[model samples]
Target chain A: MRIKKLSLQRSGLAISLGALMLLGACGKKVAPPPPPAPPPEAPAPTASLSATPNAVDPGQPVILAWQTTGATDVSIDSIGPVDPSGQKQVTPTDSTTYHLIAKGAGGSQEATARVTVNSNQGMQSTSNATEEQLFAQNVKDVYFDYDKYDIRASDQGSLQADAQFLQQHSNIRITIEGHSDERGSTEYNLALGTNRADAVKNALVQAGISGSRIKTISYGKEKPFCSVSNETCWQQNRRGHFVYEK
Target chain B: MSNSVRAIYRASLIFGLLFLLAVSSSAQDWIRTGTGLGVERVRLAAADFKGSNSDAKNPELLKTFNDVLWNDLDNAGIFDLVSKSFYPLQEPGQPSEVNFSVWSTPPPNTSMLAFGNLGVASGKVTVQGWLYDVKNTASPQVLGKQYADNATSEAVRVIAHRFADEIIFRLGGGIAGIAETKIYFVSERTGHKEIWVMDYDGANQQPLTKLGGISLSPRISPDGSRLAFSSVTKNGWEIMMYSFDLNRVVSFPRFGGMNLSPSWSPDGKLAISSSRNGYPNIFVMDGSGGNSHRLTNDQGPDVSPTWNRKTGSQIAFVSGRTGLPQIYTMESDGTNVQRMTDQGYAVSPNWAPNGQFLTFSWMRKYGPGEPGSNDLYLMDIASKQWVQLTHDSGRNDFPCWSPDGRHIVFQSHRSGGDQIWSMLADGSNVKQLTFKGSNTQPNWSWK
Candidate 1:
């Protein structure tokens, strides 16, 4: 009877050891793979544009428009080529809403006009504007001369009228974007674009506009309105753009 | 061996967490050497002939002195001579009757007065030239005249160049041996940039090294027995110490990375060069590349270290530690660091043999966003004062001093392309020396 009890105790101990082994096998740790890096953020899309043409002639019209997003204060400037294009900042103009255009890190976007400029029609003042008139906008393409980073003499009178509109409506802000042709290196062109934007800013300052109200940046030799490999397209490519921020 | 080992050990133990700048906000678009591509210019005035119309019959001999000056100056590569009758673009050779108003209006980069007296058989090439201050000819400082053997056409070039040297010397500049000196540079007219020895000014550019790989940064030893330079082959790049006296080549103590920019000790006992040690720093080795000693810590970047003979054991090199490439002085074994300049830019500090002043590029920012606006400046080592040397546009760099300490050879992009140039130590008489494909990296051979 005592021998039988010893054998039964030994079997009980073996059963316990088997249970421990099964538990160890089932509890083996396994690491999960690292979470994949978050996908890159997509650039914001520009929903709409607001264009306002102040001056309109063969030389190029004062293009005032709005990206409606990005940038705090937007403004327009013009250095005319009336005489040698040397030190000629914004020709005499009468506009309320200044031109503005801005670009972020992704694809570039331009603004349409906040004021319609019938190319055939001359500069018009927006003095006593109704709510409906103030809200209306247009879309037009303005051109620049070769190597000249300024609003053409033809556009000044019109741009000034747009400036008058902005002055009347002080609640608005805008960004001035400068652009260049693709003939030169990108780095230099980028700098050139900045120069163009600054040139426009200088004109705005002289025209009694607060510099703090306008901001600027250069897109360089990137993005073109006309891609045809010709002088005509390049002329269209070099420009000082205006887009409304507010 | 023990002494060298001790030096190395001392250098290693003293190595600290040195602060150096490899990347900087003010990086030079061009590795400016602070010298210009100045070639000495000479005028071959037609021997004023005055006799009966028949007396002009023997005008060729009268023109002999003029011919000699032309050939010699041409051979010397010192002059951009327009023969009163040979320049292709001119009104057939008559220098358009020196329109002083026009020339004076332009304010010539160099001012020279050439009055020639060429008469019949007594071939006397008397060139009374005055080297004036480039910025202002307030003083008719340098004047020289050459009296050569009248009969021979060959020796006239020599006598004229001698005259040029005298004037050059009087201007507190260099005595360009337009009459004798030769240039040793790498010419890739062949597949590789081989060592080519040519006339000082730029004529007779010939290739010396036939080695298949790339050979550059050529140096003429103190004795000029062999030319030391860097070469790249299928095996690797090496700081090659070639025995020119024996026409043989041997590379010393090959480091794992690139080895170049060798500067021989004052006594020719050691050659210091840029060796790869995680980064480029100065290393001193014997002629055979034995007993090597590293002189610097892991600084950001160090290259173009030249010996200052005045200090004897100190070297002036370009270091990029302060967010820009500036001139710094360290012991030959890389200790005792000191800064040199604070304003604008400095590079390629070519020390005078006397070590009183260092020639470096000092490019100051002129307009906003216009950064490459730079000029050559001379810095007095003791006073830490700078004398702005070059004022005009274009690039001027790669300054190498002459043995006499009066002249410096450098690469200047003044003409829109790189070429060799020389000027006085006092920042005067910048004359272009080369008119061909981008030639640079000049080292003067005293021999």
Candidate 2:
């Protein structure tokens, strides 16, 4: 009887252990599946840019409006960082493309709006078209480095472009204004800007453009393209901008 | 007995004359260096003036006169102004009304006293003012003057300023007081940068140029007849002259290619930075902008030329021929080129009227990631020892000397925007001169 009792106890222990294993299997089955691997793609950023009066006479004003979705940052090509959705009045001196970039968690999306400044507005189609357009739509501005009047390697292309336009339009007279970021004394900056304007003029003259056709002025931290006191804004301000006189 | 008595009296009379001469010469010596130049200040009392007339304008005119007189004396920077609380109960308007004991005692303890009276009658204002040495009880009065002008608040202020100046001249050595001087500066309150003028103490501010374009560096001609400034016009930057006598922008010969910062010599010659030839260089021209002779020939730009107003023999200018802008001095004829600043960036070297010191703005430690500031500094021309004038004040530049050589006016960005501020020559007693929108580049009149 003792042997039978011992055998009964052993069988009972085995049955209990088996039941524990079955319970562990049931718990595993009840647990939720590893949260479906977060969808590999977050919502991508979207951007749309438009320019009212896409075709303009030289120096005429145009409004650039842009909107973006899922964007933490938005910036324009020539202009600096701006609101995600806003409009800015720009007076482009030449045919230009404004590239807008919207960056977010997913990726960066870009959209562009082209403003076709009609340099041949009066010369080509109609006699009454816009005599005052000034060949501003033809030439481009050359930018320089900080506190430096020397032409930069990056800006060589711009100077070449400006030289090409001037060479084609022999009748155009232009003024290149040298500007500075508001970091130095006004008097000193004035001198710096003059050097910058002269640098550009010398380059154009070297490119076979007549020295008589070009004039230069140093605005010297007085007139600013942007006034936000940041590197981006300062980069825009410290430039040699071109204006058409005749 | 009669002859002896007469001889004794004559001897006493001669002794009195000698004593008076000695006292006067010693007083002159004391006055010479007493102009806020680290000397012990004279304890001064400016008592309220009495309204002596019953005209309807008497009370207002008296108030204006008293206020202006007090401020002018206080701004003179050579006096320990006794508080009004310590004033004697009875304000003395004339010599006879003064009680010397009350002023010289400990309660007031003043050595010099300024008192006055004002009146108005029949569209005219009249004032009588006196300065007294309270310690000299026997002959206490030091100055007594009378002024009359049209009965208006503005005229009353002028009278008060004149009276204050008279006292300052007598007591503050032979130097003329700056109370009547004018300060010309650049202001953008009208949505455009234009030249504006104000009294030395920041009163009567009005625009001098309404060119509706950007104007900078308004340096008044030494004779106060015209203003030379750089203005943006249809033909780039040009040196434009504004005639104070004609109250209009006059036709000055335009030097082409970015003419800027026209400074006038004491003899009426104008020095400007021009790029008419090619590079920006110093050009000394006539007052009419003719006889343009180039002074500096360099690839880097040279600008902001100022003359030694007292001698007119030398000029201090800024040049970037080196890596950065530095102060340089040369003869008026462009000889003896000497560099004044050794390190860092320095510009705007304005020579003091005395010609012994140069005041400029410097960034002693300049570059990216360097912690420093742009501060005004006063350097002795001979010794090259510099004293920092503005400390931790934001971007101080364009320091100009008052006509008296005892004060300096500069533009600072300390109080939010670039504003006109004036301080004593020793860099104390800083006062804001402009409270409106963004005034800068103060040039004190030569007078």
Candidate 3:
């Protein structure tokens, strides 16, 4: 009878242990650890620039077009900052290179276009020519009447020659320097000098030379080619001298 | 300290205090007694200043100060400075040490005496100057001044100038002396012509503008704060302004083509010549180069406008209306035109401070085969009566007036090349101010 009572008590303790283990397993099932995270992504963008009708006569306008994608800011050299995709008209005196830069969160991308200017006078063949050579062969000083800015009939031939040379060498730039004799006041002579130079420039434009190829300056009475105070010397001083750009 | 020695020092200090008080109270009663319309220069003597300290530097500095003071008084045009050899053997540095009989004796026989004491210590300079009227035996001292500054050559020269100006003011019939004023000019010393400044006596000369190109026609503002000039840049000749206070080139907007020859109005408005409208003409703009309005509309050039400081309404300029440039005066609005120079070629007119006369460069015999020589002339505006100030003195031009209206500073080619010169308003006391390379276009300071 004592052995039978011991077996019954042992069975009861086993059943209670089994019930505690079952409750612990159910709580573990309600909350579990999450899976590992995925890797990060990489960023990117695309941009390009192009010029249409890349070559043209001097003073003729050229159109510049650009395109970009996913860029926060975009800019073209000399054209300043611009929209991502745009078109612009430019009239450049010389051959120029346009570079476009597009910036984004990831990085930046760049592209370039070159416009080759065609000279009307085949100046590119003599790109390494000196100013003295150009001035001596193609251009000559134009004379003006005393205290007058009007282009004299005698100087018309010289202006015609200058215009022809400029039309042939479209890329070449020239400065029309006006000077006056030391007979009048220094300040008044300066104004007269300007008028003389402007007259020459206008004559060149009328002769089919582009105005963009010409610049004007007046030395007044300050700078005289002839220092003698005679009419013969004064006539030489009152002239529109030509200077060629390299 | 010994009791006897201390008692003696206290008694001397009290006596000194009482003497200073008497001098201070009597200083205001002293008045200049010379007539302004006299040909006689005030005879004066400048004694070597006593050295307060016998240090090595003190003697040299004292000599510099004394020499500069003597030279200043000698060149003032109003003084007959006594030679040092004829001065009294005793060089009295203070009123107490001066003996009236010694300077008033036959050899020097000076009407006035200037004496001072100078010292340098601890990198500082100190001076005590006194001007004594030799004829007034009872109250011999006419002026007393004390100056102190950093112990430098410039400081010493400045102290001497200040002392000399005081003496000139006291004896120059209430005329403010130009010793402390400056002369602005253009110098080609540095290869390129640039603006430069010097003392009125041409002592300290230094370049003010280092612009790498040509600069001309420097005109100082009435307040002496800005210098307006013309400079050549890549664009062409443009009017430029240099602010003395800022010590840099200030922005003066270009009004387009070939702006040149800027003259400041009495109220600081700029009167500039511009070719913006295809021809050069006089235009007035605000000091900051805004609010521009055409003052003259002639087809010929109208430039070099100088304002009448007395009345800001009138302008004197060079007009080429009658074929050749001549001096003309008109209202500020370009109305009521009247020609001052009837026949000769005249330009660069500078109105006097009192506005009663105009000084300009005129060639009496202008035109072909004429013996034309540019000389300075003074014209009475009301009567048109003119007097030639310079007689064949080699192409003198750009005459500017001193503040007192007693002297004129001008540029002359008398010495082979262009140089700056000054003379009395009556064409006496001609003195060369600049001897350096090719200096021209002198504009005296307003003060």
**CA RMSD of all predictions:** 29.5, 23.3, 34.8
lDDT digits (tens) for residues A123-221 of candidate 1? 233445443355343212234554445577655765575566557666666566667775432223443455566667677777777877776655555
Candidate 1 regions off by >4 Å?
A1-246, B1-179, B247-253, B309-311, B343-345, B365-370
Lowest lDDT sum, 10 consecutive residues, model 3 chain A, at A19-28
Clash pairs for candidate 2: none
On a 0 to 100 scale, what is the lDDT of residue B36 in model 1?
16
Q: What is the lDDT of residue B347 in candidate 2?
A: 88
Off by over 4 Å in 3: A1-136, A144-173, A182-189, A199-214, A226-234, B1-38
Q: Kindly report the docking quality category of candidate 1.
A: incorrect
Candidate with the greatest DockQ versus the true structure? 2
Q: Which lDDT tens digits does candidate 3 get at residues B1-447?
A: 355544554555454344334433433111112211212468898999998876668888887898889877876667888889997778987788988888888788999999989888899888999999988998888999999999888899999989998998888877777788999999998898899999998889999999988888899998999999998878888899999899999997876677877887778888877878767788988888889998788766677889886687888888777767788888888789888877667888898776767899988766544568889987767667666779878888889888767778999989988899998765767999888788988998888
Question: Pick by lDDT: which candidate is best?
Answer: 2
Cα TM-score per model: 0.45, 0.78, 0.72
- Please, what are the lDDT tens digits per residue for candidate 1 over residues B368-421? 123454567666565565556676856766577666554567777788766777
Docking class of 3: incorrect
Model 3: per-residue lDDT, tens digit, A58-80? 67899999999977767675676
Best by TM-score: 2
Worst 10 residues of 1 chain A by lDDT: A79-88
